[model samples]
Target chain A: MNERPIHVVGGGIAGLVAAITAAEGGAPVVLHEGGARLGGRAVGSAERPWVNLGPHVVFTDGALVRWLRQRRIDVPLCGPMVRGVRMLDDRGARFPFRQGLQLLPTILRREAPVDETFRAWAENTFGDASADLLCRLGGLITYHHDPGALSARFMWDRYRRTALSPDRVRWVAGGWVSLVDALAERARTLGVRIELDDRLTPESLPDAPTVVATKLSGAGRLLERDLSWPGARTALLDVATTADPGWPAVIADVRSDLATCCMIERETAADPAALGEEGGHLIQAQLGVAPGVGVAEGVSRIEDGLDVGFPGWREAVGWRRAQIVVDGTGAVDPPGTTWRDRPSVEQGDDVFLAGDAVAAPGFLSEVSVNSAVQAGRLALDARRRRAFAPGWPTAELTPERRLAVLAAVLPSAELTTTTVPGADEVAPVDETGPGYRIERRAGVTRATAATAGKGGVRVTRVVASALPGVARAAVERLPVWRRPFRR
Target chain B: MENQVRAAQGGDPFAMDALLTELAPWVGRLCSSIALDKGDDAMQETLISVLKNLPTLREPAAFRGWVRRIAVREALRAATGDRAIAVAEMPEVAVAPDFETAVDIRDTLTKLPPSRRAVLVLRYLEDLSEHEVAELLGTPEGTVKSGLHRARESFREHWREA
Candidate 1:
């Protein structure tokens, strides 16, 4: 019965998710947030309450929504309204129906190789026009100036999910403020001690399992590890107006080949409360800018698109804010690299990472959810693995041997296993432990118990028996010639 | 909503996925309240049954009630079929520092039998009356009343902190 609390740093989505996941299993958790409030980039500052930093939407198909559903956290969502979708090419705010039909085959093509660049793959798979259009459209989803230079697999996977027909997008009614509050409430309910404005240095961190869920730059400084990754720099423009010019729900501006596209979403179209003012509409626009592109230039370019999409938008503006965001939108994989090549979750000595940039899959914030859940599970396992029923006749054995022993003893138990992509499935035996559910599939990468996860069924729960150990020991006592499992 | 359901029934994978997302939280909450640790398995079983028999549902308006009935039935079957690892038999893990604050109502409800827990969950959690609970569980109103009384008494006994 170890009561030591797992510490989670930062109160952002990753930190909150990690804390909740850890605490749900009865483990004590303490969350440290440097800011006065939660919801890192997911929400806005006090000046603009409930307004997302830029534009944010949750796809019903992503990991974030899945986690919300699994945890039963009710987030009010508005279904997709694909009615007013304007495409901005060189001409103006038009559908570009003919051009869209041409790119349909490329978008529908499912798989793309990781080694190839998105530009190269699209050109080879479809045509030069296809590559040019996709790379431009890519700016809307990935706020990257040069998505054409990124990995094909990375961009393609995101494009399929992001640009799917009818758009599975669900706008959070109160922005992510509602989600953050719900997560914070859930964390507190699970007895997760929350400390606001409590930033910790490397020296000040507790000597317990901790989830460092801050941005990579902060995490690199705190963990003192080189956690650098390629991220995006984009310009954000949010304007509030009472003018109802009947603006499109979203505008993808890919007019100039010199400057990449920008995505403009009218939040009021989906949820009227977005503006926080009566008869007001919130028009938010964001576009990827090249390295030297300043805020002035980015905002002007966004205005050009706005002019085409919403006529008389300039005079109708009541309040507007524009800024340049650097590394705000997670990592972007280069031509040859993949998400697997990003910073890993398992930092040695029981310190795990949980954030958008860490090595996990999904689109945008979905990456955070995936990594947070993984980090939380690993941290929980790390903290509790040593505390099996105090009297189970314990013996510390290798993870593989432990699984082997469990297989040897529990010969009649129902075997439940998920096959590792590149590794052999651990042969398991089953029957008597009616409640024994096995998910052990992870350790093939390394033999370490922490990474042995998702699979390495805790044989410590079953293998701590004399009968199991005897079976394994008797078999091991034999020489290599006498080994039965040797293939 | 009917069109979405029809699309799902017509085997559109994306539509089906969206429907699952829409209904998952409700189903998850119900299954968890009844099945406790077995809630996940119960939810999966319930979802499969719901999706498989969706075509058989004549009234799309009755979807919510019908789904609730299926969820309760699946949860009960899952819980009743398996003799749970009794709360007392659980390994004596050290309680979190704020254990009192974190103690879920489910922990105390585990002290009662599954049937009593069901009645309590249906009556209170579902906000249904004793008569409604009787109809839901297919029991007499008197039986429902007495079962609910015992469940509440057991809760009061177990949840001294509350």
Candidate 2:
């Protein structure tokens, strides 16, 4: 019985993660997925060339990065990035928020710069035009909730990990399907048994241990009981076009509020190389439609009649679009469902529960995958402990609170720089290079200051120094490179 | 599933075409699990993904499971992150001339664990054998047999009297 394979039900992120983790940890695994294929919700269908789910971008701090890198899954990293964002108002007005050089100037007002509180910062930084754009246009796109409700911590952490880092934000070369295939291949090599259309009942799982990692409703039916989960509301849209969206990436306040939409163009004669070329496809607009944003009661309008399937450019050509809606506070687990909503890890002897919906209330492929992996680890741990005393570590993601932090701080960009003595300073002698006078400075470099651009007025303290060795003779030969110090 | 898997690997355009032709029925079945209104779009996505990635399939026998995964992924993705309208409120929109509901067994079936529920439908309802289920699932025959036994018991226990 100990040699029997560990049973994993569901092939979604969690199920796959669990299987992979278990296999990597040197345990034999048999993954049972009721579906015909694997890759749960992250990859696209056989008929669909594009991913069904909206984009699931990776963050540096995200467990996904570690999992992918550790597994040696090849993926394109870095960006199609954004530093500051612009808000579009309901009336179709546009205004940039405290962006670029303007941020430092606006920090002292009522919503002062130094305050950094979402509301105070916005009020201080944005003028009437910008404020209206943020409240209206941005509200429509992100959903209408006071930014104040968002957590500054989670938002900033994600932003810092992804946007600012040189190593964050990677898209699989073949979209998400590539990543899924690689994981599946690795699982196979590890001797993990992947069975499609093979569903699990409490009886079918190995006597060793079993973990269920399906959706909340699916898990309920398997157990013939409902588990508590918070009502979650979200929407996913996939739009395919003849060309890319105008912007590589845009997170602004638009009238049409969308949680996440990945608009892809079918491979055409235009240019296949350009697909993920500019770091990502395009920004189109600056409306980052995150799921948990603006989720308060009374902020959203209950209007319907949204039309899909029409190509914005050519009315004659039909566009392929898929939209999904989920209420974060719904009746499955229903609203007011907290930790009690989750199932006990130890379900009679060796059975345990795992899944994104089970771990916490939110929509994240990475989280779902990590939860399942953790669940598998727990299952193994339980087996080792010879106890079903809920051995696995609860995800402890702190969902809404974490999302609030993401919403509030995820958009800000922070940059740090350190200077070295040689490249950091050179005398700004008037050297005629075409029509431009390059500003060079000479000094003993102390600290590197973060600058928005490579070109600007740089300040350096004058230091007594002598040109060493042949460097002086070389400087004397190149008359165009130096100027006498003005006394 | 085998043909498409092969064509996808051999890079045969016609085999790829045949694969898409075969995908409709399976994708349609997977789409049924989701709310009906979103089925078509979700189905379209499933088919498109299956078509593009079929060639990348390393294991031909795993075709059915691969397609199933893609379809379910699309359906699940579409289910969340979209606005939900009462099913009765939205008119069913079909891209093809024929789209049918064999039975309206919504209450009992839709509620089951997606994996278990899929196995129950394919193995019992669809009359596929344990080997066939294994073939469809890309698992070994032993795992399929055990999974079926468990899924059947689970379904019977949950749906029999209720």
Candidate 3:
């Protein structure tokens, strides 16, 4: 049947790129997505203030930029240089990091009100309080963990720049999704077929070639039969407002290590006009929201569907907002984890893998998209040269066993299991059945802020990686105010 | 907000305006989204990059892809540049805007990494083919094609969540 048009599984960025390249290379491509759409984690959330993963940044050296330009993803060049950074600490101390040495003198001369001993030195341009705050926020925002535990170099990588110029920072005139939409149109024009809600399995693909590109957990699920890798979790804060907050377009990771409840409500009084001159768009790290009685309570941290919970989150912002907190560790893959660890592209192994999990030095990075694209193209090239084998993996441990191992390895409190479509049976980690199931009810919180200047909001859901138990516990622990807003 | 491509390709000032009108908002949104709290810095730099690089664009029709690439590059440069300065006491700019809900498009694009998302948008929404995208990007057609394929898959997955 014409070789089934080179089946591609997992329609994340990497998979999409693979499909495009295959079609361009004169191979008809059919892409399978287990979900209802494409773009994977790059888009959508059930809550608000809606935020994206990684703010979805791209670099000049990456392949995606070149591809977009080739296809005319028309957008202007906002420069890549940031003018400055502003950081706030647990005590509400504010600091700024700006371009050029002149600003250094100004920053160093300042003193904070919280502590008389605190004096800003010329070298302390981002501010000590904020820097301390950044340590925690940087951990959560950049690595989905505490910043103190991460590499300082990696922590600094997010803010380090080559120039002190004012215009190095840039943006797209539209939101991140606009660019995604534009790409979809381009794919359609190239006669590339896209399917949503089409999850994939090994058998779903043809023998020609394939690429699997998603986050670590997703990638692991796809490759459970082939290999094992570490997984990660993420939390995102989405906020919507009526006025421009007059803040910088980008800022450093300044996680306020305040009380969890205080942290949740910290931004409630934020003046949108003061955050940025432009309205309704922002990307920043280390944000906090205070807890309110009603719609303002935070979601819980779930563990094994029981109520092992965190304190109820408070609401500090009046805008409509939600936070997504994932629990997967997403630890860095063991060193030397690469295509070499598996079958060689030149050795004719047909099964291919791609994602941030494969390419990143840590849990995630701006380079993940590049890794996906690179892996897909490499697979295509191998297939074209007849260098791939159609054989998939069957090993000492079956999918069910592997899942069992996974449950055992992970913190038991946060996981539950069920049988997927083809599994022999559905079992929990504690169960002795041949087949098992594991599931975590991600914690999602929706809050409404009624501050002075912002719009009165409806429901918002915060997403987090927690056991279902933790989620339930957090929900019950939620202040009485949020009981009516349950989704 | 100038049509650097048309100008470089021998068009008049009017072309620059058309280009600006068509592309500026999209670029602005992109910068804000990624730059987040620091979007203005990124947006301003991106605009300047666009203005400065306009003269180098060789094709008027391929302007969209080229400009979008430049924006992403500019944003990255900005983020990285800020980190290099790393003074502990600097006042970070306040938070920027959240552009997610402001503009509406297909959810599939979200699956793409930032880079691929740019390509998908340029290729599809802007109606530029692979070669045109490649020309604007100064890369090979093959690279563009490969990126498009992966980006499509990403879109399919993300669209489901939306």
Evaluated with TM-score, which candidate comes out highest? Answer: 1
lDDT of 1 by residue, A1-487 (tens): 3467899999999999889878765579999999888888987868875988888888875678766754557789986866878888877777658666877776547668889999898899888877888888889778998888889988987787666545678889888898999999989877899999999999999866899999999999999889989999999999998688667888888875643578899999988888888898999988888889899998898888888888888899998999999989988998889887899989888899988898886678888888897788678667643332111111122333323323333323222233233322221111101111122121110011111234332222321212355565564344321101101
DockQ per candidate, 2 decimals: 0.02, 0.01, 0.01
> What part of the reference interface contacts, as a 0 to 1 fraction, does candidate 1 reproduce?
0.00
Superposed by TM-score, candidate 1 places the C-alpha of residue A454 at a distance from the truth, in angstroms, of 18
Tens-place lDDT digits, model 1, residues B38-153 = 77767777776777787898888787778888988888888778554332233332332232332446555455556666777677556688887878777778777765563465
lDDT tens digits by residue: candidate 3, B16-121: 2223323434565455344333445565565555544666766656665566666656654554464532112223223322223312332233332334444554
RMSD of each: 15.9, 24.6, 26.1
10 residues in a row with least lDDT, candidate 2 chain A: A430-439
Judge the docking of candidate 1 as incorrect, acceptable, medium or high: incorrect
True contacts kept of each: 0.00, 0.00, 0.00
Those runs of model 3 whose alpha carbons end farther than 4 Å from true positions after fitting are: A1-4, A46-54, A60-63, A75-84, A90-137, A151-169, A202-205, A226-232, A244-321, A327-348, A360-365, A387-487, B1-162
Q: Which lDDT tens digits does candidate 3 get at residues A5-108? A: 55667675656665665554445666777776666665544342124443444443223444454334564433453332333333332344332332343332
DockQ winner, 1 or 3: 1
The parts of candidate 2 lying over 4 Å away from their true place are A82-87, A90-167, A201-208, A244-251, A255-318, A327-348, A360-363, A386-487, B1-162
Evaluation by lDDT, superior candidate among 2 and 3: 2
TM-score of 2: 0.45
